[model samples]
Target: MRSTNFCLSTEGADVILATSSDEKYPPENIIDGQSETFWTTTGMFPQEFVICFHKCVIISKLTIQCYLVQTLRIEKSMSKDPVDFEHCIEKDLEYKEGELQTEEFSFPEFQATHLRFIILSAFDTFVSVHRVIAEGIAQDI
Candidate 1:
């Protein structure tokens, strides 16, 4: 029953795709395990990023820290490749000026090798994700 932040880049998590990214705000920052660094959407709504874990894992919960994000949808995939993701959860966040939004999601029975988070919309022209933490254990499948 070890708990770990599977989203850390050091943990073999990777950001496979993103709609738009600024040079200073690359998607890799979201999983860097540092709150100071972050990833930002360059433009438009419906921005997305896919995270591939090192191996299949049973995800128990997730913590997303972002700013200016209005709506978010998450999907998970158990396939070896990043595809055929099924819906996991969707949430609408509350916005507070000069403050970061911290949202937590729990899924006791969720297992996946990849997770995709889609930013459906934002409260502002752009949104920034400071960090994403996935707490879970690697499954021996």
Candidate 2:
């Protein structure tokens, strides 16, 4: 049977933590579905954020839209809380000059309650994440 797909943000995933927070560029902007608005990091490299789903989900694919990101690493946590994540994937992004660098990862369905996205490095000092879309089906608890 083909399972229905959903975006984690619309499934109640929320309130992520960023290495640094700016009122004008809050982490929440990443899910607002607006390319013009984004979550920007300040101070240094290795900026990270965690998105917690309301419940466990079997994620089939993950996509990220951003700018200036050079390298990214993604981790997953099956715990009830956002802790103890295992490495899922790491990517070296290509620069697009003046466009968004969109990265899509298709994986075998896997269970997860939380996902961590770490910006390991960037083409510039700051990086902006425009949106994060996780396509999956929610697992019944």
Q: Which candidate wins on TM-score?
A: 1
Estimate candidate 1's alpha-carbon lDDT, on a 0 to 1 scale: 0.92
Model 1 / residue 68 / CA error / Å? 0.2
User: Per-residue CA lDDT of candidate 1, range 1-141, in tens?
Assistant: 778889998999999888888999999999999988999998888999999995998888999999999999999999999989999999899999999999999887688999999999999899999999999888986
Q: List the residue pairs that clash in candidate 2.
A: none
In model 1, residue pairs whose N, Cα or C atoms come closer than 3 Å (at least 3 residues apart or on different chains), thus clashing, are none
Per-residue alpha-carbon lDDT of candidate 2 for residues 34-106, written as tens digits (9 for 90 to 100): 7788989996989999988868989898989999999999999999988899999999999978999999999
RMSD of each: 0.8, 1.7
Measured with C-alpha atoms, the lDDT of residue 40 in candidate 1 is: 94
Segments in model 2 whose C-alpha atoms lie over 4 Å from true places? 1-9
Runs of candidate 1 with Cα error greater than 4 angstroms are none
In model 1, the worst 10-residue window by lDDT is 106-115
